[model samples]
Structures are given as C-alpha cells and as structure tokens.
Target: MLHNFAGNIEMYGILDAIASGPIEALTSENSTMVGVGMSMEGIEQNPIVYDLMSEMAFQHKKVDVKAWIELYIARRYGRSSPLIRDAWNILYHTVYNCTDEAYEKNRDVIVAFPDVNPSLISSPLEMYPHYGKPTSRRAILREKKNAYEQPHLWYSTSEVIKALELFIASGKELSASNTYGYDLVDLTRQSLAKYANELFLKIIDAYKFKDVDKVTSLSQKFLDLVEDMDTLLACHDGFLLGPWLESAKQLAQNEEEEKQFEWNARTQITMWFDNTEEEASLLRDYGNKYWSGLLRDYYGPRAAVYFKILIESVENGEDFRLHKWRREWIKLTNNWQSSRKLFQVKSSGNAVSISRSLYNKYLRSES
Candidate 1:
C-alpha cells in the first residue's frame, strides 16, 4: 500500500521533518520531504516493512494518505513511478515471499481492510495522517480500544462457517475453472486445521468439562481426522496453542488440581464409560455399528470396502489390523473436522460416520 507520490514536494518536506525530528519542523517543504524520504527508506528496509505495508494497504482507514506518501517518496527518490503499480508489486511480493507468515502477521489488519485495492490512490493528503502524531493519550487509548473491539480481529465460529460456505458453494469450480476459489479452499482448510488442533484444546481446558474422559476421546478423534485429510495440523507451537494452554495453566488454583483434571480427561474415558452403562452402550453401538455403517455409505463404495476390512479386523481379533484401522480412523476424523466441512451436514452423528468411512477408504487404498 505504499503511495510513493511524485508530485507533492511540500508534503514530502513535512514527512521528512516528521521523520527527522519533531512535528515543529513540518512547516518547511524541503526539510519535510527530505525527512520523510529518509524515514520511509529506513522503513522500507526494515524486516517488518512488508508487514507494516500490509497493515497500511489492507487494514488502515488512512491508506489513501499512506499511499500518497509512499508514492511521493518513491517518486522523489526516483525509485519507481505510477505509485499504484509500485504498491501492487510491493503487495504481491510481500504475499509471495512471506506466504502463510504474511497472513499470520497481518491477518487482523487484512480482515479489517478487506476492501483494500492498491490501484485506488488518488490523493496524498488522504494517506498522511495515519502515520502522524496523536493529539492526546485519550485518543491513543481510544484507538487501542477500537482495535481490541474489532469483530474480525480473530477467527470466530461465524467466520469459520462462512469460509466453509464459500468452499461448498465454489464446489467443482475450485477444482476446475476458478483458481481463486481453489486458493480460498486451501487457505480455509489450513486455517481450520490450525484452529481445530490448537484452539480446540484451549476450549476444552477453558470449559473444564465434567466428562473429561469423553472430551479427550473426542479430541483424539478430531486429531485423527486431521491426519486422514493428509494435512499437517501443527502450528508454530510457541505462538499457537502454547499461549492458550499457558493462560489456562495460570488460571488453575494449584498444579495438583491441573494434573488431576488432565489425568481425568485424558486417561479415564474407558473407566468412566464402564461406570455409565447407558452412555457406554450408546457409544459402543454408535462407534462400532451405526457409525461404522454410516462411514461406508457416506464416503462411497471404495471407502465401504475399507470399513469392511476394519470391521473384519476388529471382529476377528486381528490385533495388528485392528490397530492399523484404529490409527487410520483417528487420522481421518482429524482431517474431516479440521476442514470445517462438518457443519455442512445437519447431524453430528452422521458426519462422524461419514468421516470414518472416508478415512477407512483412504487407508485401504494406501495399504
């Protein structure tokens, strides 16, 4: 979103002065331009320059002024002409070079400024104030509050659903004519995988579910689904789930209580199931019979064959094959949930069965 305005010498002078020292020197055109250029060039070379540019181009309200300033600076330095084109190039390269990292760093900004187009630069004055000084602490605080209050700052359940809707609507177009649709599908899938594996764990901890064992079992199933989709659910461990888990850990009254919860959730599902006959019977029926059949029907004939293998292995007490099928099931479940496509179906039960069947099919073919 860099503007690079060629014609505004005075504005450039003011920019230069602001860059060089205090706002007081902004009165002189020559000094301002020089100050602005020096400051801008320095910004351009920063490791985070691309991120800052993305913020300006894709997120900020004062992009027009920023664009103008960028153009003015670029033109003054004879770096490039047609500031819009330069801006486009900058944007393209930034996206291309950083790839997913760019999105991670500037997702909040991009979502906030979804309508941004680098080609829309008409005036420098429109782009200037966003980079300038604040009048009061109250104004700064207001801006911060506004930023935190923005609805699209983080991926919410609604946004995830919308992304899925786009994926389903695009349908065959994604695989055939529409490259953008395909990209959207891929991006949405990636985002969902991240959310499922990372954010999901946080939700479990936050809610402190009484049926901790059931939660753990469900979580494992979800993870399995991810693997079945042939997608990696791993995020930058330090930045993703780690922060949420750490926050949850901090919330616990004592380490012993935290360990107790973790043990109950992760290791006691089977024991809990044994104690609850009705729930156990329902799970067994659903997991072994109903869901298994549903999976075969949902994924198609090839997948049905795989489900048959899994059933046979389990029924005949073939430990190795049973183990293999179990692993494959987990992987498929993870993939299905991670895609965020499960919501398209009305029934969670039906979705689970379908996912299991598809995964079974994938495994049989791979084997």
Candidate 2:
C-alpha cells in the first residue's frame, strides 16, 4: 500500500526525503516486486490522487511528483494551464508531504476519542470528556505528538491555506466541464477539512471550559460546516452517501439481511468496530466520514447531544454526566441504517461553480 502524510516537515528538503528508497535494495540482486497495492481507506478518495498512484504501478522510470501531477491535471480536466500545474506543485510540497505522524497529528478528537488510547477492555465513560486529571486521551497525545509534526510540527498552515486558495481559483475556470468535477470537489473537501480541523480545537476547548454559550454556538457552527459539505457533495454521485447505502442493500436477500449489512456500513463510519466486547473495537471511528447522510444524521446528532447537555449543565450549575448520555448515543447508532432522511444524492447544480462560490463563502468565511 502507498504511504500518506506521516508527520510535519519543520525543515526544508523533507519533500525529497520520501521518494528515495534505500540504495542498497535498488542496486541489489534480483527483485520480484511487480507492482504495488493501494487500500483506498484512510485516503481523501480523490480519483486523481488514486488514479495517479495507480498509474505508478506501471510506471518504470523514476517520476518527479511535479511533472506527474502536471500530467494528471492536464489529462484530468481535458485542459492544461500553468496555474493548474503550479497549484498542484505547491500541494505536493505542502499537505501532500505530510509526515508519517500526519494522520496521528490530525486525528479528529470528537469522533476518534473513544479509541484514542485503547485498552484491552474499555470501561463506560472511561474515555469521556473530562478536564481534571491528565489521561492518555488522543487529545492529550495529540498535544504531545503535534509538537513534532505541524507548521513547526508540520507544514505551514498559511502556505497550505494559500495552496488551497490557488487550487480553488483554478477550479473556477473549469466550472462548465464535467470531466474534472469530482476532482474539484476533492480539492474543495480538502480545503474545507483544513478549516474544520482548525475549528475542532476551539469547539473542544469550549466543552472543556464548560462555556455553555460558546459550546452551543461552535457546535452548531461545526454542524453547519458539514452541512455545507453535504451540499457540495450533492453535485455528484461519486461523493453521495446513497451509493454506499444502496450497495449494502442490494447484496441483502431481505430486510433483516439488509439491516445487518447496513449496520456494518453505517457502523464503519460511525461507531466503527464499536462492539462493546472486542479489544480491536479500539479502532472505532478511525475512518469516520462526513458524507451527506452520515454528517446530517449521525454526526450532527451525536454533537447535538453534547451541546445540549453542556448548555443545560451550565444553566443548571451542575456537571454534565457524559457517561449517561454517551450510552444513549451508542444505543441510537448501534444499528443498520437506510435512508437519506438528511441530504440529497442526485445532482442539482454545477459542481465547479458551487466550489468557486462556496470556497469563499464557507471554507474561508473564517477569514
């Protein structure tokens, strides 16, 4: 499987570092490695990213990432421009160059907290949000791990933000073309995700401080960010939640079987291996998603509970018992689901145009 961002590059020359294989192996005796495999999981799901990587399976010559990405955008949108190529060139040197600690550094605490530091057996409320004694929570771990992986620990956020702006500007030029619509969405998703990651900390901090008003405001604002995401994704089926849900339903012989398969699909993005019994359930929500249906229905509800409890606790001058509510949240999600009771799947507008408009409206509204 191909590797992705592991850590931040605090110093120059790290971009050249990932591609060089050991000289010993490259020059050594017979090697039988024909090709490589890629697990699409834990990836951005951008066809271009995966497509280019797949192209490498057959590429023999040592390819430069800049040139390779240039060829990709040229072929991808049925047009080529220096702006396009250069935007990707910057991407390669920024987010695309994330260190191995990248994933761990950018871990989403709201969804991935339960398994942040897994135990052989996790107790109820064992990992619930609390401020007092320092625990081995992902939030805690992230604070330590981040120091080694960001602007100082990883890539400069300002630079990545600029690259995103450039990519978005190029996307506006191809507003009428369908060939690269999904690609544009992928770029837009990455841009918005960057903004969201920055907001995550502020949201959690409000919760930690029991700042009820701030938590209520930020929680709703956070949910709206995903809603904005769902709107962008509705432009194409590639990002729609319907296909994933439908695939699970199609393989089922009946409603019960459908529910079973649906549960796994829904569970995968939500509770993950959320079984209260298994140790490996430690991986719960590791691959959490913000798809149309999941974001509007599942994630939004989970967050609303916290917002409600926190705000109410602040008003009542009492501590919020996270244990009681977390169990209810678990019970609410522990099932196979079907329905778009939240967002649409069919295309209703031009994907690229939406990107150009929303890129400024939502993702950069913070500016």
Candidate 3:
C-alpha cells in the first residue's frame, strides 16, 4: 500500500483524464452525472493507501491530489514537518509518480533467472507453443518485456535515493509513529532492491566480457544484497511469505485439500502453470515476491545455481547448456513446492533499526 501509492494514483489520474472530454461535452440540458469507475481498494495488504483513496472518493466533487496528500501526511503521521513534506513530495513526483506506460509495480530482479543477455525472447514461438501466430507471440513477448522481463524504472534513481535519505532523517520527529517506521522499511527495501537490478545488469555485462573474477565478485555482492533484503523484510510482518502460505493451508477442510491449496499458492509465485521440457512456462518468476524467507530460501539458491553454471561455462570455454540447466532448475522448483517446511509467521526485529542498518550499509555510500 505504502509502496504502490504512485501506481494507485496513476490509475485514478488516467481515468480522470479520459473522462474529462466526455464530461465537458455534456450541455446544460444533460443532467447525467458521470463518475469515473474507480476502485478504492486493492490487494496491497496495507490500508493506508486505500484509506487515502477512500477519502478522495468520498468527496462529491473534483479532488485536488496535492491537497489530499497533505491531509494524508497529517492523518497518517499525526504531525508533519518540512523534512517529512520534502520526503513525501519527492516520492509523490518520483517513485510514486507513474504517468508513463512502464510497469505499475517495481520489478524485483533478484528472483529473475540470471542471463548474459536477460530479456524476453523476441521470437518466442518455441517458448510459447500455445500461441500459433509469430506476431501474436511477439506481441506477448513485447508486453512481457515491459511488465515482467527487463522492467525499467520511470523515475530518476538519484531522486528516490534523496527521498529515502530525507525519509530516514525525519525519523527523529516521527519516532513514535508506527506508520513512519513501516514506510521507512518499505522505502529502504525498494531502494536496495532497485540497486540489486543494477548489480544484475553489471553482472550480465561482466559475463559478456568473460571476466570470471568480476562475475564472481558481482555474483557474491548480488547474493549478499538479497540476503540483506530478506533481513529487512523479516522485521515487518506485512512483508513475510509465511502467513500467506499458512493462511492457504488453514483454509482446507481436509489433508488433501490442504495439500492442494498449499500447492496452488506455491505454484502461483513460482512456475504459475504446468510445463514440460518441450514447452516452458514464460510466466516463471512473474509473481515473484520481496518477502522474507522467500529471498534467502528460494530465489537465492536458484540464482546461485545459475551463477555456478555461468562461471563454469566461462572458465571452460564451452557453450551454456540452456536445455540441461532448465530441466535442473525446474526440478528444484518443483521439489520446493512439495516440501512441507513451515516458515515463521510472525515478524521479528525493529523495523527502524534494521532499516537504519541497511541504509548505513547499502545507501550511505551513495549519499
């Protein structure tokens, strides 16, 4: 909710703009009240953004977004200062500003399989055999390029970093505010995760040059960054994967039902659909999470396998066995889905302290 405020507002703004012409075309005789169909609720798992949207929707007249943001700050934090204003203002224009056609959500590259040239195949007829036409397959690939594979950031990274710094600086004033702490951890998590993508891109470039030493170093850094991200998320219950899995299990009336439901939840985030060696699931890693336990336990090991294969190929001067690698990776994924390992449902550690530790470790150098 706090993380995706910009995307929620973007949907509102886009609909509002589209309705403007139709609204103006109506004459004095036309008594039709055309309200844009906007949903104030989402599956964000946090209500702060939804609460703000609900307030805006309750207004019987046109809403001023800027004014609403101020009210939100006051209502959410119980008080406001220039530091808080500056931070949120930066967020409003940068990270939270989603006027472009790029993905509405931030891309988590840590879970994505590593490749020398990481992208959706332009010609995925073989990859998506279900699609008959080449053009149709290409269209799917294009959409996936923006939404899933190789996601791009629409905002300036430096501006968001500055905003995070300001957000952390306001901690002294917002110490007692629990909401502030949540946002702090979320902002920190996003900033670091974005950097992980940058690291991934660098690793790809290193692999291209066959620089084994650089690849080795960058791969370790990438893994370490993911481990730290898992640590940050573990501090907040909102970001854990445990409760979501547990809830899925608890909904079952019998053991068989429990197993099926658990499988469904696990498969959605991982494979998404059944696939064989002849046909692969293009939606793999599409529903990846930045949740605790998921990072260290799942995504990290998967990436490690890819890195190991990449290093071996680079050193041996042999071509990458894409087919063999895919088979092994899919097997690993399938095995994890069947395992009955229970994750920690409750959160631990202080959000503010962990965020500060991460900021000092990761973002301080950038500042």
Would you list the C-alpha lDDT of every candidate in the order shown? 0.29, 0.55, 0.66
**Model 2, C-alpha of 186: deviation from truth (Å):** 1.9
Off by over 4 Å in 3: 1-42, 45-49, 103-106, 114-148
lDDT ranking from best to worst? Answer: 3, 2, 1
Per-model TM-score, in order, reads 0.26, 0.74, 0.80
The stretch of ten residues in a row with the least summed lDDT in candidate 2 is: 115-124
Per-residue CA lDDT of model 3 for 259-285, tens digit only, reads: 999988888777766678534576676
What is the Cα-based TM-score of model 2? 0.74
lDDT of 1 by residue, 1-367 (tens): 2321211100011222122232334434665322222223112122223333433323323334345545543443334334323333332232222212111222211111111111122121222122212123233334453212111112232333333343334333323322222233233333333333332333233223233344445444544444433221111121112232234345568977655443332222111233221122222111111111122222223233233443343345452243444344334433332221111111112222232343243222221
RMSD of each: 21.8, 7.3, 7.3
Q: Which predicted model would earn the best lDDT?
A: 3
In model 2, the runs with Cα more than 4 Å from the true position are: 2-25, 28-35, 39-44, 100-106, 109-153, 207-210, 272-281, 335-345, 365-367
